[model samples]
Target chain A: MSHRARSPSTALRPTRRALLAGLGAGAASAFGLARLARADAPPPSGTAVLLCFFPGGWDQLLLLDPRDPSRFTASEAARTRIDPRYDELVGLGYRPELVRPRAAPAMVLGPLAERPGAAVQLTDFAGRMAVVRGVDMRSVSHEVATRYFLTTEFPRGSLAQGSSVSTTLTALARPARPVAHLSLGVESYNDRHPSRWSALRVTSADDLLATLCPAGAVDPVLADALDAYAREARADVYNRRGLVDRLQGARAVARGLDRDDVSRPFRALVDDGPENDALRARFGISRGDFDGPRARAAMAALALTSGLSQVVIASVAPAMDTHFVGNAGHARLLGEGLDAFVALLDALRTTAHPEGGSHLDHTTVLAFSEFARTPLYNTYGGRDHHSAGSCLLLGRGVRGGVVAGATSDVGMVAVPWDLTRGGASPSGTVLTPAHVAATVAAAAGLDPTAFDAPPISQVLV
Target chain B: MGRAPRRLDAGQLRASLLHATGATWTGDRRVRTNNDPSGYALRPATDLVRHYASALGEPDYGATTEPDLDPGPGFLRRAQSAAQGACRDGLRRDREVPAGARRLLRAVSDGDTYARAPEAVRANIVALGRTFWIRNLSPDGPEVEALLGVFRAVTEREGALPADGWFAVCVALATDPQFLLY
Candidate 1:
């Protein structure tokens, strides 16, 4: 490993490195790069996780932590709710009557809590949905808290050591899939995961489909030449020693992918085939929502259904960092971004899984923001950052009907909730991100002890 | 004892192709160190070229933690798709090579570079043996004769452009089993 250069290939062939140096830099703005970083071993499962991330510190008061109209008396709500940054809360604009009842015992709803024609939004899943409120995310800073939520480990020191739940689950679940982990617009991290298990990042559904198929027919001459070249170089490569191991690993991957056989099945996904069009239509892909959150969801559905990948992560940005003129934007996100996910839920429910149950019956959708918005608005006429928050999850194997933990009526202070019962209790521990990590680990079939925290058992089947 | 064949990385593969075809593009700068992960159309980053880097175990020099590629690189934590992707990219290149490189490959007359010329086809095969397989081929060596055999078959197929016969020579020498394993 000394600075010694690649041992000159004593081969009579011209020295490759020296020759390349003779060629001047061709026109190339140079370019541009997921591997997980953790050591824990989570067991694989047929169940998968579709994380719908809501960035920019979502509003807890309007979404997860509902408060009474009395508590928001106009004069007090509009004038009093303030953050340390001197930002003021925007006056509550939605009709008090619009706040509906949740399926959970005492929980109620906000504007975003719309159900398909008044079945009581979020109620049907009440028995299975466990919302852990009062989570002290420790810091209100955006970047750090976002990392804390995704990795479970503290952001201060875990940069090189942490792995996200999506990646850990990906490693555990699909060790041999053609593309095990697929990230379509997800805010992802892949530090320690081997380059082999690294994530395939795509921006659109077409991009996803095109990747599997070829440009056309492959040439035999070229194929033969490449085969010959591989033979020659592969031989000299072994003695090179410094890099042979990884080269061998890459070789194994190539052998597994049968270009003609493996990708031929994927043409159905690419050609706007009837089945895919129907599914896309069901997922709101026909509407402009295709470019919105629904697009990512559609890609996820295709990936899972096609067996192209085992884990698919999608994200949406609500710009909930509402510090200026608008407070109604979160509502728009509810209708536009959040509702797209509902369409996704509907599509998954209708799509049948090859193994028996519907994709919805086996896939779990985990949705949460970096942190919660301040219950009170600051002087900027919007909610500032708040450390306490809640999240929503749905899909098969997830206990969807109940809300876990609680927060206060005034400052939106999180109240400790009992994990066993999914209810507020003075004796309960304040839920932390570790609990979220454990919840995913447990659901995905990992040994829960591998994680430092326990799963919210009340929510798991 | 036979050992596992070492999978050559993108840099090595590109360089070997250039040398095998006698294109003055020696690629010394490239074979020693990677240009950048970006130049590689494979991996998760590019929209094109899938399932090659990881399978071949081509270390994404970019994926490694050290900013610069360490000569003594370790497994960068996970597997990537490498093997087949390169196979596809390489062969596909022959049909779609840049105009200049195509002309250069056609101009390859030295038996030492491609081993197709009857006068030095044997010498050419022997050179490939030493350079690619890291061994010597004796006079009337079986390896050289095998390469010459492939050359005749290919030249017959490409009757109009008989130079293509050299491609067969290049390929046989390149794909030799002894040359493939680490």
Candidate 2:
């Protein structure tokens, strides 16, 4: 009932040779067939996941998918029907230009990528990043699009239709941690997985501590009595549909939480200690910014490095629903989020993993928004929802500095892409959320069939 | 074949506790003192029902129309926390009044230890089982003896007083599947 690994000693251990061979085969051919070819082998272990979500639709032209200013100018806007008014963004003090960082020339990013910041920028990690452009979200509504991207399955109206990718990864992971999956200020859904893999959702570090820490410790006698009664009652219950069993299992988890003192590290979120100061400074989080993107990023770092969670999903951006005048500060909001994301990557890059490499070497980071904004600005001087979206996949098992998929030049519609060749093709498939989910699953050595879409072979290492 | 039983949602659980014991679990707002001058603020004392509503499978109706019917580990642990807090409140209220006027511990007093008064202990256990579970438990039945085992362990081995033992019994009965499920 606990879902704890029964024979951890006999669990499948991933070697460097197996990982390279698996990823090589996956990248060379369709992951569906490749996974079937190796069906007898277990998924590679020691791979962690960090799923970063930026709320509200991000403007594709301003970030992941950029248009050359010289080609799509104001005069050509009428013919192309796409206009990125870079001159209007006065916050950057200059008309932002598309940047291809010298280190990662194949990765084209928007102006915000090169923004000056106290923390690192997206350009810092471009060598380890892969940009998936022109992804079709299939929905225009915020709730529907968010869930669609989160679970890689379209929602039944506003309700999620599948288990979250994080939950899936956590369930498949062997030698589980105390809290296998942790979600901070992000929605996580679990449909059919074991209840133990359900994400421990919290808004902040303080909230996590409060949830894990006992309100008031009862006398030891009372504690012993309650635990004993629970055990006796557990045996008596018929466990219809495993409800009582899950309840009893959760009581054990509660006890483990106290026994392991899992809340001790989270206490540094508010406590004034050397490690707390170092984390705040490293993540570029000020004293009062506890629940912002930077703080969430710092929490993700601690969760991963401290071995508290195997998969962490955090909302690294404030709401960027910039419809009217709010659009003026859209770049600033996105810049802050991107800065926090890079800081998280830097933290992982510097921290050591238990498996003899940096945490970044063993972790895969997927950054996405619900959808992208329209190519053309709306009548309200801001951009509206657009069906075409883009996402970034970085860290382990991902081919770095590569761009896959593309939108059209005129309407910014997603064009059919050659998954194996990494370009546009008239007969190829259009990129969708399912493809991205499959790619993530495959990179983590999970079965791509779980996502019902073939992994994009060109994006894998 | 028996039809599967449905677990109570957070709202129904709260209402049931209030209806049965005339008490609800309410978490107090305690100020968090930290060395950081900027992170210091007066923490708001929100009620536990609202705080644990999401974990208790209560639907907001915006994203989900129906409550999460499957009770998982998170839901069960939160339910236990709620029961622990609510039963403590019930015991506190019972302790403030005379034995005749008590709502939960009417069959026994705070001073009635298992060694001193075993009949009163069995009576209190039966009364609690009937109050929370609506089942007429035999005082000498295995069910009563199992709960008595808990009381005996607490009072004898743990060296806890009768009031603490009663609180443990109250929590066990309230959080049991018989009380949680309809």
True-vs-predicted CA distance for residue A199, candidate 2, Å: 1.1
Off by over 4 Å in 2: A1-45, A93-95, A214-221, A232-242, B1-23, B26-36, B52-70, B98-101, B133-143, B178-182
Interface RMSD of each: 14.0, 7.0
- Given candidate 2, what's the lDDT at residue A327? 33
Candidate 2 CA-lDDT value: 0.73
* Top-scoring candidate (TM-score): 2
lDDT of 1 by residue, A1-461 (tens): 11012222223323432332211111000000001111121222377677777767777766566665554655675454522221122233344333444556555655456533432234454544556567778878776777788777777642323666676777666445666766665434544454444455544444444334322213344334443443334334354442444344433333333232234222323334454454445445542232346667656655554445567777643445665544465555654555556655654565555566666677767778778887665666666788887887667656755567677655777777788766778998788877876776676565565456888887676
lDDT digits (tens) for residues A1-461 of candidate 2 = 01122222213322422322222121111211222122222232378899999988888887899888888997998889788777666566534688887778888887777775444667878888899988999988888898888888889978788888887777777435667788887777777777777777766665566666653432444555677777768534446566666566556666555444455555556667665676677777777666778889878876776566778899988777777743347787887888888888887887655456777888988999999988887788788889999999988889889899999999799999998777899989999998998898788777778877899998899
DockQ of each: 0.07, 0.36
What are the TM values for chain B, all candidates?
0.46, 0.86
Q: What share of the true interface contacts does each candidate keep?
A: 0.08, 0.43
**Cα lDDT tens digits for candidate 1, B66-141:** 1212111111111111222222333335446764453223333423323245555555456656655568778485
